[model samples]
Target: MDFRAINTIVFAFLITMCSFGQINCNCSIGSYLEKIELLNTRDSLEVFELSAELKKTKLEVCKFKALEIEFNYFITQLNEEKAFAVLNELEDYLGRINCESDLKFNIYINKAKYFKLHNNYEKLSEFAFKALKEAEYLKDSNKEIEAIKQIVYLFTRMDEDDKNWQYIKRAEKLIFKQSNPIRSVKNFRWLAFEYETKYTRTKRKPLLDSLFIFANHSKKGAKKYNIFDELALSYRALEAYSYHKGNAKNALKYIDSAIFYAKKIKGKKNLSGLYISKAWDHLDWGEKELAVKWMDTSFAYDTKDDIAGFMMHHLDATDLYEQAGRLDKALSSYQIHSRIKDSIFNTERTQVINELETKYKTELKDAKIKRLNVLLVITLLIIVSILLAGSVIQLKRTRKKNKILKRAIEEQERLEKELSDVRGEIAQDFHDDLGNKLARISLLSSLISGEVSIKSPNIKSKIKQINEDANGLYKGTRDFIFSLKSNSDYLEEVVTYLSDFGGDIFNKTEIKFTVEKHISTNVKLPYYWSKQIVFIFKEALTNAMKHSNCHTVKLSFGYQGYQLSIRCEDDGIGILESDLQSLNGLSHMKTRGIKIGCELLINSNIGEGTAVILKGNLKEDII
Candidate 1:
């Protein structure tokens, strides 16, 4: 027998032995698959026999895998008839015998590839979606990524850019979830090609950059896996990027590199495609003779079945010939182009026939599956009814609990308001009654001190001490009343109070106080949050007033989107970073921010100044 036959027989023998031997059957199966993949189109008979031998295996999964390998072999050889026949066989196998979801998934992907290769867009779209659904059901991210990529390409070919972008977005999401290096490389290369095509059409700088990025990533992955084909494609992408950037020298440099790599690989198709690309660049730059030279060189490289590339070359030749005033040659080239276009039309018609046959078969299979699905649906409905009854009872309990929770929340809010009112009343009592009384005491003591100074020095000293104590008590009461006041929670009210308080406190001092409000005056906050925020602000201000020996203390407020931001900055000899660890007031400000669900930032330098920022999400906290 021939070498291929001998090789196939040996591999099959090894697999059979391993199946009954002590070695792992899966390892032997993989070896068998490796051998099959190693065979080219010339080894068709051997491939066919080896593929048929898969049915001898006891494992159903292996049978499914064998069918996939057989189908792939036919596809790679461009034997569409055999490929579809094998696909139909696989479908029949699935109908009669039980197979794993993975097997079924592979069958769907194979059918998708068949349709895609034949340019049956409608069938390809349907199969791609089916594959995606299966992949998602199996939680197979790699498979899902492949399906999404195919769908993206299909939509792009259909000129449905919006739909293509949606699939691109989906592929991006799925790619990150897959951790396989080779698969990642493949996905990135697909993305690179997609963007590269778009760049070629639009000549958009951003799209070119995107292509370069993904292409670079693909190169890295390919180098890691020793995949020369992908490496060559990456180089071609770089060439495209450079050419589009108006750098002919650099573009030619990359194309040379790509050609060198492509020569090392088995596929002359890629090599010829590169030559076509180089020719087109020369043609675009008005180098007609150089373009013709490269076109002849491309023809020398056996570009098997590269119809698109052939079309491009023919069209370019026609243009050049017409420009040279060679009417006969130009007419001949145009006629050849017309013939190629007719062939494409014929191919499209064949694909339509294939699509109809596949659809009819699918419908017949679905009719059978639908019967089984109806029984499953009935069983599911019974389970769902039981679940629904339970859900209703549980939902009622949840509703009851929600009602109780709401009532408790309302009651709590009411009590909080009442408590705030009571605190306000007490503050009013302290400010109006106790503060006035203390002031009166201070005045009376001063008068007594003046009257007794002539009679007794001891009485005069005692009256003077009483006056100083009353003055201290009055000041303390005023500060306490200010803290207890509820109006501080309102945005406008707090800002006005801060301005007046700062003006009064710093009036006699050299320091200046500034309050700048960037937010609306009508912006209101929850009572608890506003209270905490104000308390934090007061602490920061107090620290600045007591310690920062500066000219200005500025307070600013801003609201953007859902966030409310407040800043307290002082122009002063700021606190040391090391000293900040021990600052009690700063710690209190941070704690209050945490309690209010805000982010607090404190920035300080020894000589620059200090800034305190408190930011919170108003959308979440306001309610």
Candidate 2:
């Protein structure tokens, strides 16, 4: 075949395939829609059959867009009275896929209505709140209104009048802005119910007035099918208010109006409530037989499963039978009353127990979590304590080692100082007494050798040489002893020694020296301590002379009150920054100053001259 003919055939084949696929897709979607329609119409058996078929078809299609359309249809089906079918479908759909916001909201609304019909008030209230939140997110006003109405109804049934009033007000505000007569009338009716119920519970007159106003508003231009029950309830509330106010005639008149409106409604079940109201009025007026007759008629008319009204009727019958002295009838009625009362009490107790169980489980869970946290903290503390104890033991061992090393160093320093002092004393003894005696002996030997020189001229020359060498040795020893004994003095003597020493040093450097003495004989040891401090000053000045390349130095000593101060200054190149960390010369000087109970301050900078200050508090012995 040619290329053009082949292309034409391929195009036609593709179109046919596309058409077949569209037909199959539409058929699958149609099947899902038909199943939802049956469910919405309350055909539960057919819904179950169709739902199974749809599930198979969905697997065959396996498309998300098709699934979404199916979900939307399921949401529509959920709005109907056959809610079990819808809930089953919803559980499947929610399990399979996520629904759109509008679809989810519709599902919640349907679930809330279904729960209300089942008399599951707690679930009804919970779903109503859920629907309200979804409706708010979708911004759907009708859904919002419906959800609010359901919430108000649930709250009223549960006897939560405060919450009932709050939702009722919200629904009323929404209804006021809508032009729909049916919705507006419904809102007004609910508002009237809220006010009447509040009045019944609180016996407040203002609530009765509010109920009448809303009832009248609801009946305005409304069809007969609407507003009848609300109008009757409003009249009954007014009658109750009148009864409370002691206006018996007005109360009877309003009760008659209540019966009239209630009878106008087509249903006998609806009319039973009016009969009960009339029986209450008769019983209040002390007509016991008439009240019993009305109550029996009311019971005959009550066809629906109104448990509260049924219980109340039996209770009233028992009361009336007792008052009439019919003991047998009274016993039978009382038995029925007791049965219903027990049922209600048991139901309330079950609800309370369920709530308490839930609370207990929650508390148990919180207690477990708290216990775990406490255990974790305690474990951490124990671990930390062990680690801290090890660290403390190690630190103590390190401190003990450091103390032993420090004591050894101090003992070595003490031994070295003692050895230095002993060597100085031995050198002084050789110089002072032994050297002088050796010098005298050498002179006497020289004289004896001279007298015998005529006999031995050679011996005379040798003797003269020996005498000169002995004299030189004697002079060296005398200078050594004099240096050792130079600083040994009492207070007054030490002060005199420092003045002479400082004057001699200043003369050598051509610097000035000034001494101010406060030497009391009582200050002997203090003055002796200052003499050692003078050695520190001498070392600092000698350092300045060697390194400072300047000519002038000044030394000053003074005492004021209890303090003695010595200052030595030099106008020379000061200490270098690099030499400040050295521990040899300046450190020794500072140690000497500290030994004498002095605080030594060295003020020096590069090229700024040096000043050494020694200050100490004089002892009381000196004072």
Candidate 3:
């Protein structure tokens, strides 16, 4: 076994034990998932480094992610035993976590892929069937269709026409219902590859036509979705079809297009392959010089660090150089290819020998580890029980000691009541004094502006601004009083309070405003909920008057059972699709809704109307 693979598995187990031993980690699972996905996967050392990071997250889900990445790395290196070990670890993790259906389906799919890698058709078919069942149970159409495609690909490889076509039609039925035409791109590519091979062998006209038709279907779907990855592949297939059909111009053109898209995606793997195909097309068209140039370009894209890529590049280079009559270069390429091939074979043999030698020792180690883990869990349970018992004892003792303080508690409650009364009185006095003074300032400014408008035009503008400022100050003073003084904690109070403000404000506007409420009983609400709702309502109403050329606006409040809903709607020239995205106050309203833990949505269409709807659950705390 590779030491890295063994270390990775051991570290993953440590993370599992730590995460389950503690109840919470203060780390967001979603954020950790995003961070894990962004890590470099092209190197084994980076994957090993992820183990230390997983300790920070202390999440079983992170362990699963690490193991999956390690599995893919081993599989890519053709380290079959290590890959199988990782798969077994994954299966164990599934049972340990009592995993979700999606994770279970993922495990089954990985099993199918693993078996396919080993050419175990029987096992592949078994796991594929399991995945299809799991996908159906999960009620995910995309996953179900993917599983069907896997089975279809399996039968395609085995040359089972009946079973292949059976699954294909089933997948197509689901595809039509899904209505995402791009999903068919890979399916069409599979059929095209299958037919193209048969056509190459028999030169049958029907097979040739079917090959081109499926290739074109793939191309159209890929282009429609702007899926550059699949579009590059589809064009490569088209290039092959064109070459076989003896259309030199179209063949070369399609290869160039494939290269263009592969570059767009910065897909080194696909780019290297496409460059090789372009070289072959040129060589077959009797342009040996251009073929040599293209083959050299492919060498630049194929990274030297990738053993498989390096080996394949040299092998192809040998063939191309030999065909171009460059005997010396061809001989050098063949020598390098032979050296790499032998090195890979030797490495595999050595790893296999070491794996067999460690088999018994590994099994013994695993059994001991399992026993240690069981003992650790039992120890943790005992410690937790002890802590909980101590907490209960302390609570009971405190309650007994507090029983003799009843007289003091009663006196404290009396003081609290008096303090609340005094606070109310201070709020009322502050509002009355400042509000009257601001109102007097507004009245004097308005009288002076009326005389100045006829006598001095410039001074009239200044006086009018002073009158508006004074009125604004008065409104601000009243709102500050409301905030400082409100003691109501009921949804009914909020509805009634906002209702009075709406009636007064709309009376001054040409647009009609109406309030409808279905609040039955006084539902308990937190200050934060009521405050944000009031601000959101005011912002929506202001926007409607300024931006929406509306005849009437309606505000509705509703509370029934456990649900609370509010809507601010306007019968105006509704927002255009372009302008709706840039609607001012959208982010502000959304932020407010988020703070109150509510769902907020804006719906509109041209010439119809606009509606801002908010909904949330009334929690059990509302006694």
Q: Which lDDT tens digits does candidate 2 get at residues 518-610?
A: 533424344346446656866766676667776777666666666776777877888876776684888888887888778988888988888
lDDT of 1: 0.72
Clashes of each: 0, 0, 0
Error in Å for residue 548 of model 2:
99
Q: Which stretch of 10 consecutive residues in model 3 shows the poorest summed lDDT?
A: 352-361
Model 1 RMSD in Å is 16.0
By lDDT, rank the candidates, best first.
3, 1, 2
lDDT of all predictions: 0.72, 0.63, 0.74
Report the error of model 1 at residue 344, Å.
Answer: 4.1
What is the C-alpha local distance difference test score of candidate 3? 0.74
Pitting candidate 1 against candidate 3, the one with the higher lDDT is 3
Residue-level lDDT of model 1, residues 1-623, one tens digit each, is 55566456555655765655542224155456545434332245755676667767776656765776778767665667888998998888765544444467777788898887665666776778778777766777878887787677665544567667767877877776777677677678778777777776667789888888888898898777666667778888888888788887777887887887766654223366688668757765678778767766776773444453465556656776666555676788788877875665465654664464356447657856885786575455546555878999999999999999999999999998998899899988888899989999999998777777476988888888889999978876765676577765566766776667667777778888888888754466765675576568777877788889888999898877767888989989988898788888888889888987889999999889999998888765553
- For lDDT, the strongest prediction is 3
Q: Best TM-score goes to which candidate?
A: 1
Error of 2 at 601 (Å): 99
